[model samples]
Target chain A: MTDAYSSSRLVAGVRTGQQRSIARMISRIELGAPGVDLELAELYGSAGRAHVVGVTGAPGSGKSSLVSALAASLRRDGKLVGILAVDPSSPFSGGALLGDRIRMSDHSGDGGVYIRSMATRGALGGLARATTDAITVLDAAGMELVLVETVGVGQAEVDIVRTAHTTLVVSIPGTGDEIQTIKAGVLEIADIHVVNKADRDGANRIIRDLTGMLRLGPPTPPGEWRAPVLGTVATEGRGIDALAAALHEHYAFLAAGDGLEQRERAMASARVSAIAQNLVAERLTDSGLGDRAAQILDEVYHRTLDPFSAATALVRVTT
Target chain B: MTDAYSSSRLVAGVRTGQQRSIARMISRIELGAPGVDLELAELYGSAGRAHVVGVTGAPGSGKSSLVSALAASLRRDGKLVGILAVDPSSPFSGGALLGDRIRMSDHSGDGGVYIRSMATRGALGGLARATTDAITVLDAAGMELVLVETVGVGQAEVDIVRTAHTTLVVSIPGTGDEIQTIKAGVLEIADIHVVNKADRDGANRIIRDLTGMLRLGPPTPPGEWRAPVLGTVATEGRGIDALAAALHEHYAFLAAGDGLEQRERAMASARVSAIAQNLVAERLTDSGLGDRAAQILDEVYHRTLDPFSAATALVRVTT
Candidate 1:
């Protein structure tokens, strides 16, 4: 854990192309502290280069397997790839959780592909705060593409997934209930839909249902820019080449950009958000205002004042 | 829409229990500009009386219907309730969408029950920034109890929901196939488990499954309380009375002596987080470094400099 404190140095070394330093640096960033904002800002320069693809769906949907296959295919094409497998944190005791990465141990030795696991520390919905920072680290490390595989932890929006250059929403067969159960937030974010584990009995039906549902929502496009539906039996490494092709085509399409302003806007937004988070953390921890705020809240709880006043009081004490 | 703003003002007027100026004063406070923060701070005295209950679940798990039923039940008990239903925002156009509030129209005439529908404006997982402030307004308005309902917009950490004194997670039957879909963050925050629409065939089985799973998780007792599980057919209004009783009991149980300390600690923590957020936001917006950031990021993209040095330049520019 001490490694996390000096992680900025590791991140720096990694950005300069030190392999071991990059590997260690990523773990530090993934630890998710208030301090990572600075490191992330540092990495911002090298980011926005990689064709980032986010893969997410229900847990145990064989997402990691799909990611593994996809990364292998990308590597075969002589492209350096980075893979992020976000695992669920133990709600009971928050710690290093990697139940999703058990399958990826087989492919660990593949030099061209680097895989890392992330924990959320009981955060609701999507990947932990540090995953993006780690991705930025990987992006700076010169990976041609990055694949972020996450178990959909009951999230509706999956915004983190959507922030990537392209997003793949992978669902398996026999999700008849979830098809109706999940909200529109995740669906709207999808650029490419993958029905993984296609070897199952209801694979064809799931694909059909997904296709029908997708059409009901929005018009995909005029000619070829529409979100495509793909099928893959990921565990057996089937249909991976097609998935890889779809990823490349999406990248090329994005490369032929309509507007760079929107992309720049998104990047600037992330930068601003990161800055805000860092400032707040610093104030709360380093400043004695935290104690005074607690005292005011305690007084309010006793019916002497209110929280709105208490919040205002915090501003005064700090100033 | 104007009514809500006026209603918000009316709330602020009543918060200080100054019923004479309540209507006109509330109108001033409801404008939702930066100035309202000051008025809310002034009314902060009456806010602590309310025990906030946050109700959340996967989308289409009938959260809106359940909240409606719960509010109706509370109204029958002669309790003045404030309801905030948070729904997903449209990706194309951002607006404070009210699409999910149709079920809540029944209480339109009931001045005691204020129902506000909020839209998630794609702020880091589709939540609007003003949500917490709006909730605080409801609290200060002299409403005895506030219910916050969300559509699982994926914001990590969920510190917003953590502010609620109690959180109920509603699930339905036939959710077994999608059982892995339950989020760890939401599940952990549960103070009470509600199986709404229990009239379905698999109701008892869902109960059993919940019990079975809760056992695996082994109730560790959050903040000296063990979350209870209950069943309800919210549409039929069954089990609501018991749910209400349990909630009141929990509220009373929470307010008795030692419980205040716990609640105080939670609020204190929130204040720190709030203070931190404000500081960061102010710095980022006021720095006037947007152009420089864009320029340096452009340079880094072209490989003129590494991200590490680019970030330092950005910091130097801003600072």
Candidate 2:
């Protein structure tokens, strides 16, 4: 079949919420296969309907289990849910996804929930871009809600969380060194805080500390939302209902004001910049600019021209 | 003075190893002041002499203390040193640099050692590129050894360490779960492993664990170097000499083969790509393309155009 015909059929399948087509489309997007951008463009108009929520924490914070519990709860609510587990540090192991899949097998045969894992096989920027695309795929596939779970609290993970409408920062008791956690800047981004493993010792203290820290933060403007700290034993499914209710409430809060539109615009701008960067870099290696790029790179390697200057010259050449 | 004349004077000062001039140049580089590219282009020919080493670890791993000890040892051996302490998570509480400075005051009056702390106030990619520029400034200023210290084990930190000729991964006892540490991908990048605070209990076991992990890694070619795990009581000045020796030996191993040249070429390509991306983004904002770019972004915002498709159109227009 022609590429156009195949891509159109895939797009139609995604619109009808076909699972096989969704998975195949995501694979193509991640690989940057030819003509995928056209497919994405056709599907893009159908997005902006799914609520994207990001869950992030350090390892051992029970992020996976919490995400699983949340997904189960959402499923019970009659909402079609999609989960994307992003592991940026799993360059070697590649096993995090498998373990998560096994844990999420309870929803295997159900069409109401879809689970997928994304690992970093190349640049962090590329992984993030691919993630944005994959979310679009799931969103186009009629998923009412998409959950993004990142394994570490580094800058890359933080960037991923910024894509979500509501972000949850998960913490557990007795991780050692309170100072490091504070310094990580997690407090600034969370729309909600989940103290997982509440059955463990020190859970109450952590909850109180987070509440105090939120109080100490800058005062919220009138009509703005304030993040709430809650405790949960995710394994036992305790507090899952409250967490699910909070998500709905937060979505309503955003929809009540201009916050939703503002966030969508911001996310759109970020996406444009990332894609523009990739295009510019690829253009340099294209047929017309390839020889000049090589020459410029050689000069940079030999120190005859600095990198910034070479970049300036290359941009000028393109224009 | 005219910009050209003043920039020339600054370059001359840097070549003569004037600390004040070096500081000013690095500030200009970091802030990306106007005309800094020309200055760097002129100074680039004088670099490629400094031996760049990277030290990275998790927070509370005593990386700063170990770095200070290593710097003092390098000074004792009559080497001019420059240290860049990179903190990618310090979005708020810029206090990390202040605390680090207080601890590093021992070298305050020493003309042979220079220390600086870099925090993330913008994109992680921008910080990494600025770091590469700062390293070049120090190299042009006649520093014989430059050390880069990072406080996290994320992908961003890993990318920063890849710029170094030799990378040392620091570890400490009682940092909690061994599985999390191992999953961080720190083991694959180490040229040497240091178990800081060796006087503490379980230091030996940590060292043994690192050594065993290294042994289980891929076998080295006959002439290739194998990383060694050592214990260090950094606060007491114990084992600093051995760590310094390992660094020198690793550099020599690289210099003995094509490793040094290969690494330099790879670094050059990365710098070029980063600079090129920045230039392309900037060009899209220039007079000719700015209005068109805004229109395209608006279309993307309204879901009339996908970001990838918009980017492709922008690149085509630029060419």
Candidate 3:
């Protein structure tokens, strides 16, 4: 069975919407198994096409319901959608237990849609990389819309969701963290804010807090690109329309090419630099430049060398 | 200058109420420079000494002020205190730009106390290993008490504070995330539940929510071992003494040999694993076995081989 899952077959199957093939393809990419790159490269071209919406917030914020409703809305508009629900690995198993997948299980029978879960098994930065590749794979699979739902953000949330076309930073009332969330780097990247469960007490306060803080940030064109903080009760399926409308409004704003160019620019810079770091580091290690590498590593340990220096030297080894 | 920072010097300076040397010594250890380890080992004999207290909660729950007041209370009791504030680094700059540091900056001139801020840089895992090492340095520096305040009970908070003799999870009136916090892995580790800013509107409601949730969790004895939920207005210095007293009471309970042994065991296990991983990774990168790594990297990227396979192949080469 595993042999049947050679890189070529996996890629072919994944392209045709075969679950097993997509799963196998993800494993190959994760493991960096052979032929996955060819599949990924083919995927790369077909990507840059999906309306990738990223959903992230403090947990219990009803992000999954929001994604579900948004997908349903897009489906109503006659577009196929793909959902990637990212879950944290149980430290013991290092695999997504898919506990959160239960929230979106209602869409399992939707033929026009796909949902996949990925885990970070202490891969550090690898989770974000896998997510980007998976989005590409889904794009190549011909999905017109993609929604990414993160289990929760820890220190790595910014790195993971920075790829989305329009990223929503969801927040719940009562977290008393309106300022802290902004400080945590979530506020800077959010194109929309979903004050989820806004029917609850203090919901309006959260919105007001976000507005006040957003004003203090680097000059984002006021009103031209105001992140409409919408109130939503995802569990009861109320206010999802407003959320969807807010998203589309954001989409149209990005379609102006300027907005998208900036998003594309950010993602491109991240991708190029990340791959370069890993690849160059590997090459330097291969060329028996042990002493040179060790010195840099020691300096990094000593705070005398930043990661950029080590990464740059690794890249410069060829030059 | 770094040489004037060992135990004797710090203790001597500390006797004269010199705060700068104490801060510098902790920073030196937190950076984990090459020579810091031996100094740490020399100082280790004096550690296992402090009734280390851990303060953690949501980002805006005012953990810093709570810690500051707690430290102040301890200082009033003539106890030498050390405070370690763990703030998230700005990815833009690799420094701990602690916005909350202002809450505790008033103590900068106090000689019977020390405060140092640590940031999470590129280190993998939750707490930076350097932060862990710095705590050990402070413990050895003859401080009678140490308050280790981490931003939140994200993975890093749990990892860093789990070894504390007493761990307080600070929460505000409304973080509606009481359940989510448990799910995210903070509840299970909290030694005390502190509902800070009791003057806030939702204080009692959160307490009710927390109390109910605590009932649903595995029942622990209502003795000193069970975590108690307390409330305070840390900014106004209300309930600080009570909180400090609770901390000392918890510390005394844990100071009995059982808690001491458990803490030591965890520390030893952490040290061994950390050292083992570092050494093995180094050995693998050295020994001119670099190309096996390169070949493996190439294979992973080509999607012909998975990362696990490459890692295994590289490990075999090390052998």
Best by lDDT: 2
> For residues B97-205, could you state the per-residue lDDT of candidate 2 as single tens digits?
7457665687988999988887765454767787888899899999999999987777788888888989998888766524455777777888898888889888878
Candidate 1 deviation (Cα RMSD): 6.6
Query: Which one wins by lDDT: 1 or 2?
Result: 2
lDDT of 2 by residue, A1-319 (tens): 2378898999999889999989888878767788888888889999989999999876678888888889899989899999999877665454556368665686788888888887665554776788899999999999999999998777788888888899999888877533455677877889988989999898899899988988887888899999988899998999988999999999999999998888888788778777777765565543435666778877887888888777766654123
Rank the models by lDDT, top first: 2, 3, 1
Look at candidate 3 and tell me the lDDT of residue B176: 58
TM-score of chain A of each: 0.81, 0.93, 0.82
Q: In model 2, what are the clashing residue pairs, if there are any?
A: none
Ordered from best to worst TM-score, the candidate numbers read 2, 1, 3
Q: Candidate 1 on B108-193: residue-level lDDT in tens?
A: 77777777665544244323334555556667666778888876523432455666888787788885522532544457677888
TM-score of model number 1, chain B: 0.77
Q: Encode model 1's per-residue lDDT on A232-259: one tens digit a residue.
A: 9887889999999998888788667753
CAPRI docking class of candidate 1:
incorrect
Looking at model 1 chain B, report the run of 10 residues with the lowest lDDT sum.
B310-319
How accurate locally is residue B271 in candidate 1, as Cα lDDT from 0 to 100? 52
Q: Candidate 2 at residue B210, lDDT?
A: 80
Provide fnat values for all models in the order shown. Answer: 0.19, 0.51, 0.01
Which RMSD values do the candidates have, in order?
6.6, 3.8, 9.4
List TM-score per model, in order: 0.71, 0.87, 0.61
Q: Which order, best to worst by DockQ? A: 2, 1, 3
TM-score of 2: 0.87
